[model samples]
Target: MEPIGHQTGRLAAFDSLRSNVAGTLYEAGDPGYAELATPWNVAVRTSPAAVLEAATADDVVQAVRFAAANGLAVAVQATGHGIASDLDGALLVHTRQLAGCTVDPGGWARTGAGVTWKTVLAACADHGLAGLCGSSPGVSVAGYTSGGGIGPVARTFGAASDRVRSFDVVTGDGRLRHVTAKSEPDLFWGLRGGKSSLGIITTTEFSLLPLPYIYAGALFFGTDSVADVTAAWSQWCPTLPPEATTSLGLMQLPPMPGVPEPLAGKFTVAVRYVYTGNADDGARWLAPMRAAGAPLIDAVQTMPYSMIGLVHSDPEDAMPASEASCLLTDFSADAAETLVGAVGPETGSPQLLVEVRQFGGALSAEPEIASALCHRDAAFGLYSVGVAAPPELPAVADHAAGVQSAMNAWQFGASLPNFSAGGGAAGFAASYTPDVLARLSGLAAHYDPDSLFRLGQVPAR
Candidate 1:
């Protein structure tokens, strides 16, 4: 079937979809179309042919079937944290109404596409269990895991995708199927890191970690100590073991409501740490860095796993943001010095945060059943984020690129799928190896022959 264009005929065809699905459907200029289609980044705009606030898995199936029969593309959004396309002339299945989360005390969880990490964290905490969630717990569990979620405790537990047991998904052909390693090996491997390429996941079930508390938080140092802290962190990271996960950030926070008095409207350095071992040993291991400089805020301590978001304190509200990232071969002292010279306190950088996260340990280990998440050997990951208002957008993008260029010496020339959002097709291609990308493309052809989800983060055949 030929793809539908933006015309009155396409709008009239959606009338059949509205009656078939048990959900609300909105067309362009509808009361809630703009609000439902908007994403959390607020930087990229999306205008789908229609939006379906899916009430159940059947709703997703109906939407996909409608798109297939009517010659329209298909896209899915939950929290919209990682939207990369404008989704023009597509049928957007918004899964916010698919809120179902059930945690089994036996150490596994089943969450609907709409459920966020915050909900899962709280539910699992009741049983002294924890799910591997990204820095911000506000993101959708299915969406984050679909991109091979790397989180605060990644070094200890590995990516969230590594723990997934199965997925209830609707493929491009509009058939609902249960996907697992044994049931459909190829789809199982691709869906974990391929995002929405092969199907729209309606539910995800994954194993959870035991224990409810850990030694985790961030230590903040003022501008005067930024150099010393960065150097110490660089030296200290190489000596750490698998039980510890950490990242160092060069922050230039604006004076705002959530900003602390000491850190607001100032340049500072943050040493974010999460140690899953004994509290004493975690503190002892952190002593060398603590002694590096006089910290303005020493907030590191033993905290409940449910409160994990405090380690990074990523903003929960929607705002315009420009983000860029790349993997690093190694973060040597020279690399650390170069980073400080570029985006540190003295550089007059416009970026709100430039961070380098240590990667390895369990994160580098291949799962028993492999996934499409590549770049496991990267030594570290570098990311930069800046507020992107209309006037400042150009400056933010340029400065972020300059930072990436400045660190080219240690760059590994690849990025994590979760961090490569909004980078377009080239960025998406960089997340995988040539062979892995080829495999995904082949699977896309087998599962979605019509390329219904091609407008998403999927690679072209």
Candidate 2:
């Protein structure tokens, strides 16, 4: 391969890459450069030296090879829901064109990097199979699973990463390899939760649960009952079986399109539940919380597995938002009280939503194959989100940090990779234990000798 021009000659040199790739390539100021470079999080401004909308797995290989040979770093994006960096001066490979979804009724599915969980969920629903998808089915499967996917049913099943069977990836050295537990154990272990620290996944194959339906939905409570409902939820979580998963969210929804009339322009609390067991038993188990206060909307009922996204009702559209999260060792009564006092209704909290999801149960079990995912032992996970334009961005960020500080007593000092994006290296390091971090760092050095992925969420050496 011929070496491209460097630095001052970089703009013209990208022409060579365009010729080598079957996909469309966009340089800075190119006609489609802005569109291809934009991420789902509108707040992050990505200005890559070039953008290659990868049309095939080979396009990824070419991008990697070109970047490696040209002394440019490479970054990968699917739906851009988890963009952690601006990707300035890098070679951005957009995989949106690699849309492919194939489901085997025999209890597994294979999807392209660009495929979202919505596609897989629809395909799997046909055969009474369910993929372990995150709260938002709109997120890319490869991207979510790559970060150790935790979802509404995570407590009943394990994380989506725990279900992964293999990945077709392009490593930093520009090699396309099929990675599985037996074929490439190290890569398999790292890729499951390392989130693009080692390579760019072209496709992913994973097991699917034989779940036709689940008794699940959200129970919304009025502001007057927020405290009682949250306190009940905190006390109720400990009694739930592994077959049941639950979370509570304190929401301050703005009156807007899609926002329900009862929940719009007011503070509310939502008790989200998903039970894989008998519907009758599920309802019986949820009785205590149901009696905590009169529900403004009781949408809980037996529903087809494809409708799982209703449990959380995460926004389907892209918007500018700030997020903060931490794991909790416990959510005792005192912790619950503290949380209510901090971000509950009438607390002057600026957050759009603050949630605490119950952990443990199947989620705490050791996966048959060990992966880089850690902090499974945490009892709960706390996350907060706020939508703000640039002017309000700083206040939103500061408020998010304040919410975390309010719950510091119960924090586990760690977090899940899926919820911890844009944290830079220190934030990435906080997600793993020292040994795990050291292992990931060492593997990154070996696989990415030139530190091509060093710019974003990957751990530092």
**lDDT winner:** 1
TM-score of each: 0.98, 0.97
- Rate residue 113 of model 1 by lDDT: 96
Q: Give candidate 2's total backbone clashes.
A: 0
**Which 10-residue span in candidate 2 carries the lowest summed lDDT?**
1-10
Local accuracy of candidate 2 as per-residue lDDT tens digits, 16-47: 77888889998888898898888887888888
Q: Report the C-alpha lDDT of model 1 over 134-154, residue by residue, as the tens digit.
A: 999999999999899999999
Residue 276, candidate 1: how far off, in angstroms? 0.5
Q: Residue 426 in candidate 1 has what lDDT?
A: 85
33 in model 2: Cα distance from truth in Å? 1.9
lDDT of each: 0.91, 0.89
For model 2, the stretches where C-alpha displacement exceeds 4 angstroms are 1-8
